[model samples]
Target: MKKEKVVLAYSGGLDTSVILTWLKETYGYDVIAVCVNVGQEDDFEEVKKKALATGAVDAYAVDVVEEFITEYIYPTLKAGAVYEDDYLLGTSFARPLIAKKLVEIAEKEGAVAIAHGATGKGNDQVRFEATIKALNPRLKIIAPWRIWSLKSREDCIDYAQKHNIPITVTKNKIYSRDQNIWHISHEGGNLENPWNEHDESIYMMSVAPQDAPDEPTYIEIEFEKGIPVKINGEKYDPVTMLTILNKIAGENGVGTIDIIENRLVGMKSRGIYETPGGTVLFKAHKALEKLTLDRDTLSFKKIVAEKYAQLVYDGLWYTPLREALSKFVDHTQECVTGKVKMKLYKGNCVAVASVSPYSLYNEEFVTFGEDDVYNQKDAEGFINLFALPLTIRAIMNEKKIKEEKEVI
Candidate 1:
């Protein structure tokens, strides 16, 4: 009889590699490893070869970088979703796409279940399982960290060593990292302690702020319908555009943040994130929106952005609310087409100037110099109307005070 097959979200890393072997030994199931590429700097051929060598009956390397950029990254960018006002939801958005791919492969391969290496305490367990549940409710989910005896990374290292498993992590240096085209995040090891300063050697896609050059680098980005299309007057594809910006911004020590964040699992964790290109794009997009979007739309979108960030961070990407919010965000971005010049210096990306054809700013009405559209006399009525509630409240309070004095 053929053994039941389990499709694993295998990264060929220490965690998943160990999980692959353990899944076979523990459950007597054939493990099929699936590695989905979202633009991380990894050799897919090597990853596939490693998976097969590590006892996977079959292995797949799925390339979804372009789809990830266009579908996942761009939508989040358009929504302006920033978690807790700082995190750009890089890992948050990527998880759902990865889970979706796993589900697709599992269905095709006739796998009985999908297994993952997400830890029990971390938010990724929820992110991965939630997407799996939402997409295909019938497939069984196996999380090795939640069920296995290995308690910590050290234990995992020991297990890998005992099994003669090919591994990269060791007790001396073990940092759990997640990387993609948008950003890279570092956790575990010294990062677990909030008080400990992150070592600069951990910097992968960016430089330390203090080490940045003294001179500022300026670049202009153009957006069409809230999507970045060109940089410095050169048009490029989404992947190329982001790659170019990452190189420029990373050199300036941009988009590195060491934060102690509240995970969805009801615990706090410290992690360092590098998002050089994403930071520049977000700043440029906001600058363009300021020029094109009206006051009410921008103000309301701020609230929408907060909620959207929360939804994405919580792995609710496949839900109805996320779809509705994306639609609303798309509507708001109809006029969000423009160019923004940014100044990058020592980890700071500031929008120096912005322009849009749909800009609501009227020089004639607000010019400091005398102009035909000048309405200096209109300010009196405008201020009174704007402050009418305050005036009415003051009048009511005065009348009450006078009546009280008379009674006394």
Candidate 2:
């Protein structure tokens, strides 16, 4: 008789490591670990080694940094999708791609089930399971956190210690963090208490704003069809460009946001997110859109952006609505090609200038100085026609008031 195999989404973290051993010990299942790297600062070889060492029958380290950026990150960026007006949707969008990889590997391995370390309370559980269900509904979904006896990170630490597993997380430093090329998020521990201020030591990708250098950092970004193509007149691939931008922006303390956001799980959670490069990109991209996009299109796109953010945050990326919204966003980006100069200083990212060939801002039309593009006398008729409805309403109201007074 052969044991059923389970494909586990492994990060070589304390949770997944303990779960890998636990699944083998408790359930008698042959566990295969899969670590998908999306530009997080981790040694993939070491993660694989740790997974194998922790009793995984086989382990794989999949590098999808380029695909993550081009397919997932860029589409979200072009959509201008920012959750709750601040979150860059870094972890949100990445979860779907990760789950997709897990499903693919599970299919390849002839596995009966797929498992993930996402907790029952967080939004990630929904994200992972949604994508898995959407892609491959037949595979069993095992969420250890929802069923395991270990109640907290401290318990996970104990479990790992007892199993003699190699883990970096300890009781003293137990902040739950998720990192990728786009951003790093810090939650749990002190962050659970909304009144408690986040310590400066928790900063990972960026320096504290107060500790940033006195001088401002200026950079220019060029976009083609609303996708960033070059920086400072030099074109680079997606991964390298974002890596460069992260270095510069992080040094200047450009992106660090602490917010109490409404989780998709129907709870308010506090998190600290560091998205240095993403913040600068969002500001610059929005500036370019302002320069090139028409008034009505831009206004409607704002509404679309909010909905897009909701879909990503709620883990509906693989659904039909998200695809339709992306198509609409792509069409909007057709004219959103331009250059934007940004100023980064102590946590502030400001767009200093923007220019586009498709820009509708014509100096000849709106110049206060003498210009032939407009007739000075044209405003009177336009205003009169625009105000006619308001004037009619006011007249009706006055007539009603007069009638009431006569009745009195």
Candidate 3:
């Protein structure tokens, strides 16, 4: 008799490493480990070796950095989807792509079940499971964190030690981290306490604002239909552009955010995020949009952006609503092509200038200087017409007050 095979979403990290072994031990099932690379710095060969050594039937490392940026990252960037007005939705968007890959591999391997290391309390569990179910509803989902007897990171470490599984996490430095091309997020450990100041040592992609160099760095970014194309007059592909920008922005101490955010699973979690390149891109994109997008369209798109952020945050990427929102976001981006100059200093990414061929801003119409495009006399009729309802309401109220005084 042959054992059933399970596909595991394996990161070469403590939690997933332990889960990979535990799944095999607990169920007597053959585990096939799959690691999807979205530009996180890691040793793929070592990850594969560890996966196989930990009793995985097979191990696969799939690189999808370009697909991740162009397909997942760009759309979210174009939509300007910032969760809770601060979060850039970096980890939020990456999960769906990983889940999609997991399904694809599971189908190819003829695996009956897929497993993940996401804890029951965190948002990633929902994200992974939601995406998997949406993509292939027939596949069985196994979430080890929900079922495992291990209560905390300490217990996982113990299990890894007993099983001889190599892990990087130490009990002293146990901050849970998720890194990708766009950003890196740190949570758990001391981060669980909201009052505790985030330990600067945990930062991987950026320097602390106070420790940044005294001099400011200026850079120009060019965009095509809301997607960043070039930096400082040098055109780069998606991966290279982000890599260069990350280094530039990181050195300047940009894109470090500490926030207590509301989770999709009805709880609040505190995290510190470093999104250096993403911050630069977002700042540049918004500056360009200000020049190009009209008043009404921009205003309405703000509402859509909020909803789009929520959808991604809640792990509903494969749904119809998300697709529809993407279409609308794409339409808005048609005129969002432009160039923006930014000054980066001590954690600030400020847009100094912006220009676009589709810019709605007319210098002659807006300037206070004398111009043929506008007349000061035109304001009287415009203001009166705009305020007509208020004027009538005031008159009616005055008449009613006078009548009341007479009657009294």
Candidate 4:
């Protein structure tokens, strides 16, 4: 009897490893394990071997590093979309791309369904299923976490041990982590208790501010239309620049954030993020925009940025609103070409100077001592008109109070 084929979004983690075996034994499905690498460090060979040994009919590891950065990270960066002001949208952005590949593999291999190890409680489940539904509605989604009677990681481990499966999870160190080129997120474990201070050792991309060097590191970034093109006067591609910046910023103990955020799953989830490269990219880009963008555009874009961040965080990546917002953002970046000099010290990214060809800052007009433009006396008329409504309201309030006292 030929069993139905199911392609899984496999990561060689404890949950997925157990899932691979469970799908075969419990459901009688021919499992095809597809691991998509988006810059997270893993031994692909060992992952593949484990998948094969754990009852997967076929195992494959796909490298999507360059594409991950170029297509996903760069576009998000261009939009300046940071989720909840701290997250660089690492996990959220990677989820859709991985789901797309799973859909492709399912179509290519004639698989009847696709599965993911994301638990029913988490946001990844929503992100993955949403992408799958948008990209390929015909393909069925088998979310084992929702259906399986095995309640916890402990149950999964017990199943693995009973089935002679290799297991790595232990009770002592049980943090759920997601990593990519943009950032590494640490959750679970002691993070559930908001009072528990995060152990600094768990962080990978950045060092603790208390341990940062006494001396500061300074760097200059050159942007071509809001896309960082050079560091220290040397031009490099997007990925390469990010790689370089990550090394430099991480060494200096920068870009670590601890926050309690409202999850898309209607829960308050606490996390610590290490985003060395992303922090540098955002800081430099902001400094460049100060030089390039006009006051009104810059102010308006802040509102757009807040909405954009919320949309991305909520995993509305494929919606028309997000697409429309992106179009407006891309327009703002047209003249966002510039160079910004910044100083990094003890987790602080400080902008020292910035210059752009399209700079709206006119020093001659802004200087207080002497200027041909921006006459100081013109402000008297401007202030009068601006305050007229407020003055009228105050007078009316006084008249109303006097009338009330007379009636009393």
lDDT of 1 by residue, 1-408 (tens): 999999999998989999999999999999999999998999999999999999999999999988999999999999999999899988999999999999999999999899999999998899999999999999999999988899999999999999999998889899999999999999999887888988999999999989999999999999999999999889999899999999999999999998888899899888899999999999899988888888899999999999999999999999999999999999999999989999999999999999888888788887888898766898999999999999999999999999999999
lDDT of 3 by residue, 45-110 (tens): 999999998889999999999999999999999999999999999899999999999999999999
Candidate 1 positional error at 197, Å: 0.9
CA lDDT of 72 in candidate 3? 94
Ranking by lDDT: 3, 1, 2, 4
**Poorest stretch of ten by lDDT in candidate 2:** 166-175
Clashes of each: 0, 0, 0, 0
Winner of 2 and 4 under TM-score: 2
The C-alpha local distance difference test score for the whole of candidate 2 amounts to: 0.93
Residue 178 lDDT, candidate 4, scale 0-100: 91
Error of 3 at 190 (Å): 1.1
Candidates in order have lDDT scores of 0.94, 0.93, 0.94, 0.86
State residue 313's C-alpha deviation in candidate 3, in Å: 0.5
Model 1 clashing residue pairs (backbone) = none
Model 3, residue 90: displacement in angstroms?
Answer: 1.2
Runs in model 4 with CA error above 4 Å? 395-408
